[model samples]
Target: MRPVFRLLSDELIERIISQARDILCDLGMEIHNDGVLSMLSDHGASVDSEKMHVYFTADIIDKALETAPDSVKLFDVMGRQTHDLTDHNVYFTPGSAAINILDPLSGEIRKPLTADYVEYAKLVSRLDNIASQSTAFIPSDVHEKISDSYRLFLSLLYCEKPVVTGAFTIDAFNVMKDLQLAVRGSADALKEKPLTIFSCCPTAPLKWSDVTSQNLVDCAKHFIPVEYISMPLSGFMAPVTLVGSLVQHTAETLSGVVLSQLTQPGTPIIYGGSPAAFDIRFETTPMGAVETQMMDCAYNEIGKYLNLPTQAYIALSDAKKLDAQAGLETSMGATLAALAGINNISGPGMLDFESCQSLEKLVVDNEICGMTLRLARGIEPKEDFPAIPIFEELLREKHLLIANHTRKHLRDEHYFPGRVIDRANSSRWEEEGSLTIGDRAKSEIARLQGEYEPSGLSGDILAEMTRLMRAEAARFGMARLPHEDL
Candidate 1:
């Protein structure tokens, strides 16, 4: 069995779900979309039309949970299955929607350009540890209106991996969906083999913005997979206690499940969140705090309890630079999220409260992801029951270097990190100039970029995507998209 971590007992999980149900029935949620409100009203939910509030009964919640799938399957651009988001299986992905990127040479944070985004996509396509590529950071060169679909377009063009992305506006969703259809060749094919998981977030204190609510509805209609990101700030937007915050998270996420199921039964959705621990003194929400990590693990347990695939925005740091604090917080969060078996772990390469992306940090976190994946595999008996024979052979030979058993199991049993991790001894370290993690990461980045080849998508598909992007860009007065051949 895989190693497991839980912060809430069976009784506690049941109580939390019960309280969440009570909150929905009694307190209700304010949904800003009129169509969603009307749909909920049609489906037996009590609707306060004047107040824009929708109260769900227990039966409706039960039906929603029953209809939602227990797991979601993801495929790469070429229609190869990449992830089965079920059970205790875990996959790591870089965090999404950062506005700035950390420059490797100068070690300074600045707005990213199209070139920066291209390099990021190429580098992530080469990283084996990261299961999917996210729209990691936004490029300032593009029109602000097309930022959402533009990032998706760039990622799809340069990388073949499935994307973890989101939409910023209701209109952008159509363009983004069109881009996916262009790659998959048809709407039915795109639906049959999903190439992306869009993230839809609900506001804290039980609210859904117009854009996000509409995005959820659109995703449900198209048979696209989505992950609900409910961000509840403990002690501020939510109750101070972790359980209280979890109740709020559950209620908020459950409300989204209801919305999606009501739109279309059996719509794929992951029970995911990005809630943070609110720090009173600084009046800031810290994603790296121990409390935040704890809340992430606990909510994952609740998701599993409800028999749904899980996700969390843990394993990321809030530090501004690649320092000891960055490593400490990121490593701890990644380890915990892995042990908890979150279906899609999103936080690697994120910094400064999820506003910045660091290429160097991303390479380092790739190693962390490797180690955590090995940890989650747990120790299993692999031809070791007959230990006397192996030990006798070892005693006779004085070493197992050339042993057949040794050669076969070595790679599977041990996780050898890449150059980003300093595994050299003192003498070897000095001989290699004692490079810091950042220096090694920089070298790794250069090497990967040198190794990155074309994603091999057809020229016609590429042209169609560019045409769609150009049309969208022209609407915002953008004459040309930066870094494009056109």
Candidate 2:
């Protein structure tokens, strides 16, 4: 049997779920999408058009739960599967939508540019631990209307990993679909081998915006997976208590699933969240706080209880710099997310309360993810009565390092950190210039950026993707989209 890493009790799981049902059935939700309202009404929900209240009966939520798939398989740009949604695989993608890029050497936070997209995606592709890519930085240089689609375009261009990104509007989402088709060759092929998971966010306090709702429906209609990033801050946007906050999250997520399933049964929907607490002193939503971790673990437990594929917005930091504070907070949150068995963990490279992104931080977080993933791999004994083999080896006066058993099992039993992490003694460190992890990470980043090459997408496909991207930009009133390395 797998180890009991779950946080919520059997009874409490039922209670929280029950509270969510109450919230959905009694309180209903404020939905801003009329088409979604009509869809819900057609599926046995009561829709109040003027009040914008969409109520789900217990029966409807239960049916929607049944319609949601238990797992979602994500594929990379090359049509290779990248994640196992059923094995509790904790895949880390960089944090989504940071406006600024923190330069590792100069320590300057600069407005993101198109080149930042190329460099970031290439670095993430070369890193073994970064299993997927996200729209981590939106280039401030792009036209505002096509910014979201352009990020997806650049991510597809530079990264081979499966994309974890979103669209801001239905029109932008349509453009995103066209871009994927330009690469995949057809809509049917894109649906059958979805290389991206379209994320949609529901507003806090049980509200789903019109665009977010439409995005979910569009993803379902196209058979692409959808992830709901429910963000609720306690004592501000949500209730002060953890249970209260969880209840709101439950309702919000459940509401999304209901709409998605009504749009298309058997649609893949992920139970993902970034819920946190409101800090009074700073008046900020400190996503790396202890309470935020608790919220992450709690909602993850609820997701497990429902047996849905789970994700959480942890593996993050609130530190402005890549300092001790950043390491401490990011490590703790990553470990918690792994323990909770979150499948797709997003937040690497996040800093300054999710307002900034850094490439060095991405390398540092990779080591942390390796350690957390090692811990999540619960202990498995190799042999029965293994102490006898150990005793015999000791009796022979043979060092364990030279033993066959040691040679065979060391890789499984221990996690050897990457080159970025230092594990040597003081003397050895002095010989190696006493490089800090940051210094080593800088070296690694440079090596990756130098060695990286964009996968040679077919010339025909490349031209088509470019055409779709430029046409959308022109539609958005741009005479021309800014040219990059492409």
**TM-score, one value per model:** 0.99, 0.96
Deviation from truth (RMSD, Å), model 2: 1.8
Regions of model 2 farther than 4 Å from truth: 1-4, 383-385, 394-397, 479-486
| Cα-based lDDT at residue 252, candidate 2 | 92
Clashes of each: 0, 0
Error of 1 at 38 (Å): 0.5
Residue-level lDDT of model 2, residues 1-486, one tens digit each, is 234366679798799889989989988999998999988888888989999998899888999999888888887877888887754667888888898889877989988888777889899988777799998988888788888999999888877888888997788989898888877778788877877888889999889899999999999998888888898899999999988899889889988889888899988788988898899899999888999989988898888788888888898899888889999999999988888788889899999877899999998898899888888887877763658978788679756777777888888789887788888899999999999888998998998889897776787877888788988988868766665544
Using lDDT, give the best candidate's number.
1
Model 1, 218-311: lDDT tens digits are 9999889999999999999999999999999999999999999989999899999999999899988999999999999999999999999999
Model 2 / residue 358 / CA error / Å: 0.8
